[model samples]
Target: MANIKLKGSGYGQFGGFTPYGNVTVLAFALATTALGAAAESNSTAAVKNGDVIELGILPTGMRLEDAQVIITTAMTAATTGKLGFVYEDGVDDAAVPQDAAYFINGGSLATAARLRASGTKLVVLPKPAKLVLTVGGADNAKASDIKVLVYGELTGPK
Candidate 1:
């Protein structure tokens, strides 16, 4: 398994559109080659089961409304993933620990379809945090391309 960190705008904030007053959406996309790379270093390796892909970040005072995974290209059979967040270092709040599968848990990546959160789970970040995707199942290293869309709102006072 590897920890892949997508580089060069492979993932980042989705600009120009706010669903509502303070709501924003973020999008992360990766191809098989990108997913196979090592953390912070894009090497053409192979992703394995249990590989964790560090997607991007969510700012402080942001309420995570929902997350969706879109499989633009189908992955290997049985490949699955879980989307969640982990607070960055120095966060004062401890109420919210890292939830590896807060959004989609063991969701299938074997087919090209849109997968969303299992339930209405809302998380307000006490500080800046890293959004992540943990890949699972056999032959995940063979996955093609996929995208993750995150929706959130700035809860701080304007």
Candidate 2:
């Protein structure tokens, strides 16, 4: 296993940790070789409402720490809709996916500007993840590339 440590020193009551004198220590263990290799999964796709795209498949024993979704294409004022991320939990028996076992409710694409949603937590996908969008009345042409980045630990063989 590999480990990274950050050390600094010096602290002033009003200035916080001083760059020169006070001490601050940040350390973390990589845990396993596989975990160190699981940097993140990056998937990009042009998405529309009711469209399902698989982001990635997280190994069975790994734990997803966080996720981020960024709307690469700027949404126009005429574009109005909702975008979401869902991960399969290996339990639903329906032919069609209804309730997302683990989901991150992203911002409405209706915004008149680009959107960046990050730090979504408590998501663990033992299977795979898909993107779901509801583009209410937005112009289909306004839909563009969407990027999903999932961060996690892969403790088992991929």
Candidate 3:
């Protein structure tokens, strides 16, 4: 589903064009090739010093417009690392997840600081949740193998 139409024209008072006509309709859906990646403790360990890892979930009726977080292996200072997203209320099967909803807040892995960061693409109609991707201030002694890549789409009823 893809339909975008935006037309505008209206300004009279003392400006000029005043015929009057403005239309805006945007609806974009259908995006899912099934791309995935998750890592925080899948081995290659080395994250400590304020490490809050999770990084996974969002498959049942997906709806994550876009997300990216990668730090191959470079975390000395980490520039106060932070790659975010959290909202998993599974009732009781807990494992450290109080509440979070960060869309790439305070993100930096400092190896030149630009490992990769993206989030913010949803003009409405984005539900079907269950997401967790956390990594804040990874210790420092060279943080260590952290990778998280979450791509979106699957707006229900493929």
Candidate 4:
């Protein structure tokens, strides 16, 4: 039930875009104890089940086109994660309820592979939101490293 803010969290606005207008690409690298210690425990630790890893922010009007979790180092057996978004205000909007697993839901993290969004669950944000990774199944102490890539486009007026 801990919230882990990774190195690149809240940095989507600074993420570079492709030559084409508003085509955004953001990447985040995560490692075990990369931030050194957790404020809650005051000790270096690994991600645990139910931990919410804030990856970055998606500005309003951005439509999430794709996302990928690349496991650079394998994790513990049965370790899994979900990729999704939450509103910046931390409240769900009734019109478009916040989906905690809108992208890769319950995807495996126990092996070295790239897990990509299925493309069927793309989201067009109504407002600025936080991209997140929710750890599941087991503690990820065995995970050495991982990389997250988020791809999107700004569909709203410039």
Residue 155 Cα positional deviation in candidate 2, in Å, after optimal superposition: 2.7
- The sequence of per-residue lDDT tens digits that candidate 4 reaches over residues 1-158 is 99977685332432346554567787876666543222333346667888887777778877788888998876777888888889999888776678878878999988899998964856668888888888899886553577888888777633
Error of 2 at 156 (Å): 2.3
lDDT, candidate 3, 1-158, per-residue tens: 98988776332222234444222221211111112112323544444545555544554334344555555554556444444444454442243232333346667654533344444444211222344434455444442454455554443422
TM-score of each: 0.76, 0.42, 0.26, 0.75
Q: TM-score of predicted model 2?
A: 0.42
The superposed Cα distance between candidate 1 and the true structure at residue 43, in angstroms, equals: 4.0
Candidate 1 has an lDDT of 0.75
Q: For residues 37-86, what per-residue lDDT tens digits would candidate 1 score against the true structure?
A: 43333556676788877788878877788988988887778888889887
Pairs that collide in candidate 4 are none
User: What lDDT score goes with residue 90 in model 3?
Assistant: 43
Off by over 4 Å in 3: 1-48, 51-60, 63-66, 70-87, 91-108, 113-130, 136-150
lDDT of 1 at 135: 81
- All candidates: CA RMSD (Å): 12.7, 15.2, 15.3, 12.1
What is the TM-score ranking, best to worst?
1, 4, 2, 3
| Model number with the top TM-score | 1
Q: Give the distance in Å from residue 30's predicted Cα in candidate 1 to where it truly belongs.
A: 1.7
Please report, in order, the local distance difference test score of every candidate based on alpha carbons: 0.75, 0.39, 0.42, 0.75
